[model samples]
Target: MEVLALLCIVSVAFTGLTRGAGLLPDGPLNAAVGEEVMFTTTLAPTEIPFISVAWTFGDKPIITSNVENLTEPEYEGRITFFTSTGYLQLRNLSFNDSGEYRVTIVPRGEQQKTGTTRLDIYAPVSNVVVASNTTDLAEFNSTVRLSCSSSGSSLSVLWLNGSSEVTESDRVQLTDGNFTLTILNVSRFDQGPFRCHVFNPVSNGTSDPVNLSISLSVSNVVVASNTTDLAEFNSTVRLSCSSSGSSLSVLWLNGSSEVTESDRVQLTDGNFTLTILNVSRFDQGPFRCHVFNPVSNGTSDPVNLSISYGPENINLTKSPSQEYFEEGTDISLICSAVSRPAALFYWFLNGDKLSDTGSELRLMNIQISHSGNYSCQAFNPRTLRDETSQPSVVSVLERISGSSVTPSTNLPIEGKSVNLSCEAAGSGSRMWMKDGSYLILADNIALYDNNRVLSFRPLTKTDSGEYSCNISNPVSSDGASYNMVVNYGPENVQIAGPSEIRVGETLTLTCSAESTPSARYNWTLDGAEIHNSSVFTKDNTGLSDSSNYTCHAMNNITGRTSSAVHELSVTAIPAQTSGCSAGCIAGIVVACVVVCAAAAAAGGGYYIYTRKKRAKSTGDEGQDNTAYSGSQELNYADLMSFQSKDGVTVQLGSQNNSSKDARDRVDNSRPATSSPPTYDVHMQRMRSAAQPDANGAQIYAQIRNS
Candidate 1:
């Protein structure tokens, strides 16, 4: 038995040694679907050669090799082996190919070596879907079940709210490898976007988010006043109502009656507030708010509204009211009112407030200055209310007992009539005086109306004086004086100045006028007014400036004017002889001498020419006359006469060749009684000469001597 046991032990040892040959993967040897997987076997180093090496997937042989590689039909194109290392690679692995892979090696002399490896083939989770039983989630009223599905092997399912994993809780149950989540009593807190995640060894995938929404219904309503304490008349008030949940409708009610919106009442802020404008006593009431939703309704408790008002029907009265009273009279004024709260009193005079605070206003002593309108006001301080009374007028009159002289005009124009009246309180005799002297009436001054009126027909400067009117009554004697003023025009107007003025000479003219009031002067050139002063000055007079100048004196107070006119003649300046040069003066003198010499020479030339011509013309006539005269020794005057065709006589004088005895005898024989021919006759002889030269010598000599 020992020897047999030894042989069995040896056999067992041999099997163990052969089985020690195993496969080693690079890592865990996991692969996704459609990927490659490898299995390899290592034999102890030996001189013996292997008979065959084989690889199988699960229980099926996929590749076998000895000198070369061989693959089964199932893995023919997808399997490869390294003959030198006995390593096998499988390509395009599927999920069904996931399992243990074994490889066997047979050496020439050693025991056969085999290796096994586990290959996990995974298909990444695909076609993932998350579905919920219901999309609508209700607060505290619904449960939601969600499921996740995918078409992949070895998948793990997870629930996610965004990127965070969904934590497990009492209300949340997860089953089916966490592929399904059950939420109990879904609430607003549970409402969110949920997602399902599926993962495998190779990859992970997530489904689209599924959102949950929560619905709610109205729960409670609250209504309150914006101002809870008090509401006043004619004041604005507001009430607000609110609800617990969304999508709620609200309404306001006043003591079970629905309130309607009007001009004075309005609903605002999406029907959350009820506003009452200009609140009155009728607006006070108990108000409530009602709110409703599709599933529930709620109502708020009533809130009471109270309003306050005061002080009405106010009036004022005067004690012993009268339109007019005498001085030293007393008057009383009273103010009254009807109000919930007693009203305070205030007195006003001519719209001015007085210091008196009582209801009665008393005037102890009235005077003329106190004649004015009076009024009173009643006010309620608590309610801020007030009322005013109509104004009452009071007048105080005085007796008219003093004497006064009233003139028709205080400023009477000169030469205008004025009437002065004397007044007395009672019937009395009246007398007038001038300047504190007894008055005497003249034709221009007359007294009328029982000597009470003093009339001046035409007022004068002397009429401007103090005049008094004296009156005697049964009870008194009085007098009044008036300072009368007579306004007179600008009169006696005169202007003083030189009538003739030279160019480049300064001229001044002064205007004066006599009047009651000093007059302002306006100087006018021609018809146009020029200056406003009493004196007018011209620094340099120009020839063209000569004009009719007038001065107008005006009394501005009396609106009277007087004017004076004067003619101004401006002469040109004399030529300046000192400014002329000696050459210029000599040239002027030479021109004058030349003119005179030229005239004299013309006279002499004409004299000679005419004398010669006359001598020749008279030669024939003289010869004829001499021949006639020789017969009778005719007198020279008679011989000189010659009858012309026009019946004019011509006398021929002795020629220069005439003998001196003949000329002397002619001169000595002339009758002394014959006055020398008158000057007119002489002139006629000169003018009658047919030829100018015939008389030129004699006329020239005569003109020269004369």
Candidate 2:
């Protein structure tokens, strides 16, 4: 029943409907986005007399039943509707006009509909062009940002890098509602027309082409130290540079030649800074700073550094007294010099400079030929100057014979007690030996005095060597040889371990050794090497780091290696049992002391117990011995203390040997003077005094006063 009622209503509304004529479009139109186009449809009467037509769009009435006309905003002033043929014309067509148009007509109170058509508005087709910072000979691997714009909307962008067109990608972005385009990461090949096309359903548009220009030039260059002239082999200089605007590096060149790697010249930072730590006369030259860019070449003017220098003071001297000596005796001449510009030294004999191409002038094996006047001179090229010293005269001496040295039959085990004697064939009264380069005269070795037999006690290795003596004035000298040896201790050692050890954790180690004196050590992990460190440690087992490490006791002087290695290992109680933390550390100290005591008692019988036991056990004992050794180094401290015999204290060790024993050991034939011999000469000379002349100027004229 509902369906029948709906059908009746629809029929009543169409009851007066009749077919009518209306105008409509048959094709599409073209125009720019902002421009407008018109589309029109008209209504007309059909098969009716004395009747009028009404125009209506869709279901809305646009004109009265007796009238026929139509117009739209998109076609205002450009659209017209006619009733005769029912024709309509649209003047402007815009994007918004692209829709269907409908027209309705009515005659004699009867309605009719007939018009229906479609409209499409479009803009004309055109082309766009794109460009970059450069085109021909573009910079390689450059960061170039590109852009493109057109006169139309709804456009797409296309880029051509050289021969290849870049597809729209993440690196390229479109903005301004797709009217403008941008490209990033432009390379050398990215140089060409980029196209921008604007299009819609009707037409397409494009822009003209643009070219790019890129530059690759070097920048940021500098030099170190202002250019200046300096002395050859006496000055230093440096140069440096950096680059910007391009990744191309800069190189340092000396003239047209490239500088090679050398001790004096250095290059760093992509061939930027050229450093000359030191300069020499031969190193003086023109230097160039050059830059090389991928697109271009750059260079700086040449800078020159000049050098000049010269030599200064020269001096000559003779060793030994310049006094009289026998013919055929040996003599020495030494030449020394200082220079301002640093000069070469040359020796001259009798005013004639030696041309042997060597600095020294030596006269081998004394002969009459060696007796002459000699001088030396130093010359400098930089200063163009030379200097000469006063001449020196040399003389020779004759040889003398005698029993110069007496051998020491008994050698001291602890490096003490030695003897030396010289019997001169010419009856020389005194003797001396060369210590280092200087001569030391001694009357007696035990007591170094002016006039006494020579005997040396508590001798060191340095005491060994040749000795010469003279018996009387003008007597020939005699010579002999002797040898002394000594023994020393250890040095250079490192100790490492926990400041405090916990109980039962295991793994505690203490190691030490001798170095320079070439020594080995006994290790004590918790307490002692060769003994259990568990006495204080909670664990009985030794840590890998712990052991009796002996820098095997070595005496550099004796050059002897230790016979045994010291090893130590220990086990510790758990921290809970040992009061673990603080208690464990205390236990360690007690254990060390106990072990030390045990070592001391065992090494030497308790009856002979001395610090030697301490020295043998703890490394500190060696230090004590060293202190004592330094103090006890000399056997005789006071050489002139005959009155207070006890005044001379030998510190190396306790001196129990009496002076009487020293005297008894001495030869009875040798004069044993408790008071040492001395040479004291006093003489007086008388002379006349001169009186001044009337001028009172202290005249040089011959005058005398009584």
lDDT of 2 by residue, 1-706 (tens): 6576456535644452422222344434344544544444332323343255444444444344353343434334755555444455554445655545555433344455455554555554454444444443436444555555444444445444444655667656666555445556555444455555555655655556555544466665545555567764556676666556554667677767887668878887767777675465445567777787556667766677776633434677765547434554555566666655556777777888677433456555666456567888877765656678788876444445655555455332224465555554433346454543334534324434443345555554445555444444342455554443332334334444443432223433443444333454443334444432211222423334444443234454445444333344433422111112333333333333443454344442111101111111123322223322321211111111111122331121123544523422322243322321111200010012122223222111111110
- Summarize candidate 1's per-residue lDDT along 551-661 as a digit string, tens digits: 999997789889999889898633212222334333333333343354445442111101100011123321223222221222212122233334443333334533432
Q: Worst lDDT window (10 residues) for model 2? A: 678-687
For all predicted structures, in order, the TM-scores are 0.29, 0.24
- Name the runs in model 2 displaced over 4 angstroms: 1-76, 82-87, 92-99, 104-113, 118-140, 150-165, 169-185, 214-297, 300-706
List all candidate RMSDs to the true structure: 31.8, 41.1
lDDT of each: 0.70, 0.47
lDDT of 2 at 135: 46
Best by TM-score: 1
Alpha carbon deviation, residue 366, candidate 2 (Å): 96
Relative to the true structure, candidate 1 reaches a TM of 0.29
